[model samples]
Target: MNARQPCRERRQRRYREQCKIDFEIRLLKLSILRGHEKMTRATEDIIDSSRE
Candidate 1:
């Protein structure tokens, strides 16, 4: 099975790299969503304060 070992290792390495990329993308999206929510919430607060 020595011949197949390198192929399997290469596949595993590629999968790990893909997983890392996916994780970073997810983190970036989550942060963006959070920032958007924070921005909207702040705007709402400003509107409410101005009405009083």
Candidate 2:
């Protein structure tokens, strides 16, 4: 039973680490998407201004 306790704890720790990594990756992806959206908006504004 004692050996099982350590093994279980190790698994829990690894799961938490993986969750943290996943969260960071998601955040990075969201930031990149937002940057692209901003760039697209800026480009549209430029085109509109040039048409005028």
Candidate 3:
């Protein structure tokens, strides 16, 4: 039981680090998608204004 404690702790720490990395990746993807949407909207607005 004593020897298993350290192993379990290490595994938990590794899992926590992986979760942090995944969260950051998701945030980056979301921001990129938002930026893409904003660019498309801006382009549409320009095209609409030109037609007027």
Expressed as tens digits, the lDDT of each residue in 1-52 for candidate 1 is: 6999999999999999997976676566556767877646665455446434
Q: Which parts of model 3 have CA positions greater than 4 angstroms off?
A: 38-52
Model 2 residue 17 distance off true place after TM-score fit, in angstroms: 0.2
Q: What is the lDDT of residue 22 in candidate 2?
A: 67
The candidate, 2 or 3, that scores higher on TM-score is 3
What residue pairs are clashing in model 1? Answer: none
Error of 1 at 23 (Å): 0.4
RMSD of 2: 12.9
True-structure lDDT of candidate 3: 0.70
Residues 1-52 of candidate 3: C-alpha lDDT, one tens digit per residue: 6989999999999999997976676566556767877545665455446434
Q: What order do you get sorting by lDDT, best first? A: 1, 3, 2
**Per-prediction CA RMSD (Å):** 12.9, 12.9, 13.0
Please estimate how well model 1 matches the true structure, expressed as its whole-model Cα lDDT.
0.70
Q: Predictions ranked by TM-score, top down?
A: 1, 3, 2
Task: Please write out the lDDT profile of model 2 over residues 1-52, one tens digit for every residue.
Answer: 6779999999999999997976676566556767877545665455446434
